[model samples]
Target: MPIDIKQFKEASRPLSERVLGFLKDHPEQAYSLMELMAELEGKADAASMAWIVAIERMSGKKEGSATLNKYSKALEELLKQGKVTEAQLQGTTYYAYGGGHP
Candidate 1:
């Protein structure tokens, strides 16, 4: 199932909630930030205008170095809240919902 970021945004939910819901809905799969972005935007590429807008709204960073930076912040917030956990493999981070610490 494809997700629509715009719809979530329009629903007046915070980005973190949207993200958590996505992860919760797919508890068995781990996702990278870009993969999560792609899934949220319903696109293969994470650089689309829709993605940029959605990310900006989520991060409140008007001029960030990169979307990944903001996304990382959101992911870190989730980690702190215990809504998500991450695993590092070969210097790459993968995030998943639940299962406590990764």
Candidate 2:
């Protein structure tokens, strides 16, 4: 069945937020797309999964391949806007808050 865009947007909100939060907590370390997806799957809804698949298809990529690319892009934008910083991490590459350690 085709997924509704509005529902997808709603579902994606928390997933995106989670992704950003993870990045903010672990700035220096890199993660595979699969790893991130695995982490996301634990908490995301079907709509969130749809977005992940869409991004994966658009990138012509597999799990964990483009994970950092997407993450870096989001982080770069946030950094540029002064909403976040690279100094947030001490040395960790992965972080989970309330969602459990990844």
Candidate 3:
């Protein structure tokens, strides 16, 4: 469901702030955008980002984890930037570490 109008009233702020406001108003819920961010984001060093990617791989137990929609988001981000490189052979995605192209 979309955020209520009252929620959007407070959503004009930056994303972290908007999420904060949303959580404050509705502490019982969770949202997708919140899960989409990699831990530490830009602050993470290369090694750390790789570790996070591994963790996300191992720990994905959410409803969308098994769906193409969820993995597509991850594939998009990886295609953009990450220690993990992706390549498709036939229909399967293959991943490997290091700066080399997959």
Against the reference, the lDDT scores of all candidates come to 0.73, 0.53, 0.42
**Candidate 1, which ten residues in sequence have the lowest lDDT sum?**
61-70
Tens digit of per-residue lDDT, candidate 3, span 65-97? 333344346445544655334556666454433
Please give the clash total of every predicted structure, in order.
0, 4, 0
Which lDDT tens digits does candidate 2 get at residues 1-102?
A: 887896577557744466666655776644434455555555355456547667777886655436445655654555465544343245533332322233
Candidate 1's TM-score reads 0.65
Candidate 2 steric clashes = 4
Quick one: ranking by lDDT, best first? Answer: 1, 2, 3
Error of model 3, residue 91, in angstroms:
4.2
Candidate No. with top lDDT = 1
Superposed model 1: Cα runs more than 4 Å off: 1-11, 45-66, 99-102
Best by TM-score: 1
User: Of 1 and 2, which scores higher on lDDT?
Assistant: 1
Instruction: Provide the TM-score for each candidate, comma-separated.
Output: 0.65, 0.35, 0.27
